[model samples]
Target: MSGSDRRRGVIALREESCTVCMLCVRECPDWCITIDSHVERVPAEGPGGRPRTAHVLDRFDIDYALCLYCGICVEVCPFDALFWSPETDYAEPALGDLVHGKERLGEWLGSAPGAAQPDGQSASG
Candidate 1:
């Protein structure tokens, strides 16, 4: 399989599906859920100066590199903005690349949240 066709194993969101409730935003222990919205704007003009198109996703990502997947972010989301999907095919050529940001997690946002993330997280046994 080509690297372009591979998938990420972390969770993310659906913008339209997100109600901007800030549930997941609050519950995230890693402080990873960065949300960009329509509220913050410069107030420019559009094609016809018709109150130019706003609502930009400046940042809506999870640092899978940092994400413990404690599921707190998923549990707190009242709008069902986040979720875990069946796809978990993330492979990184470098350690830095393995860190999943917002764009990558956006694909599988669901309504399911799991248990709390364990503290003192380390990959070692």
Candidate 2:
């Protein structure tokens, strides 16, 4: 495929940006995306303000063995934390190795395509 051609690439996750909303998990037809998070209370910004709770990501894994490459999870990510990485050559000797965690997914972010421009032009344009 040419450089401009879009590939049915692997999924890349930005764990820091993810809100752990479970939208991707619920939208995945193959049930390949797994996420675990916890709620933590943070001190109020002001004296009269109530404490705020934040979701801390504990675990995020995607079983490529079960994934259909349908991009449902990517589309359902409200936080834009999920992306399509063109580096799809992640073949492994063992089937278990195909199940990638957050670290592995994050690595792909380096090679993933940049975000589109607001004027509907490709980043390269």
C-alpha local distance difference test of each model: 0.59, 0.83
TM-score of 2: 0.85
Residues 1-125 of candidate 2 have per-residue lDDT tens digits of 78658675898877777898999999899888889999999899977999999999999999999999999888888887888988768999998989999999988876667644345664334
lDDT of 2 at 63: 94
Task: Please list the residue runs of candidate 1 whose C-alpha ends up more than 4 Å from where it truly belongs after superposition.
Answer: 1-9, 40-56, 99-102, 109-125
lDDT of 1: 0.59
lDDT of 2: 0.83
Model 1 lDDT per residue over 55-120, tens place:
555567665667776878766777555666545677677866765655566544432133112343
Whose TM-score is greatest here? 2
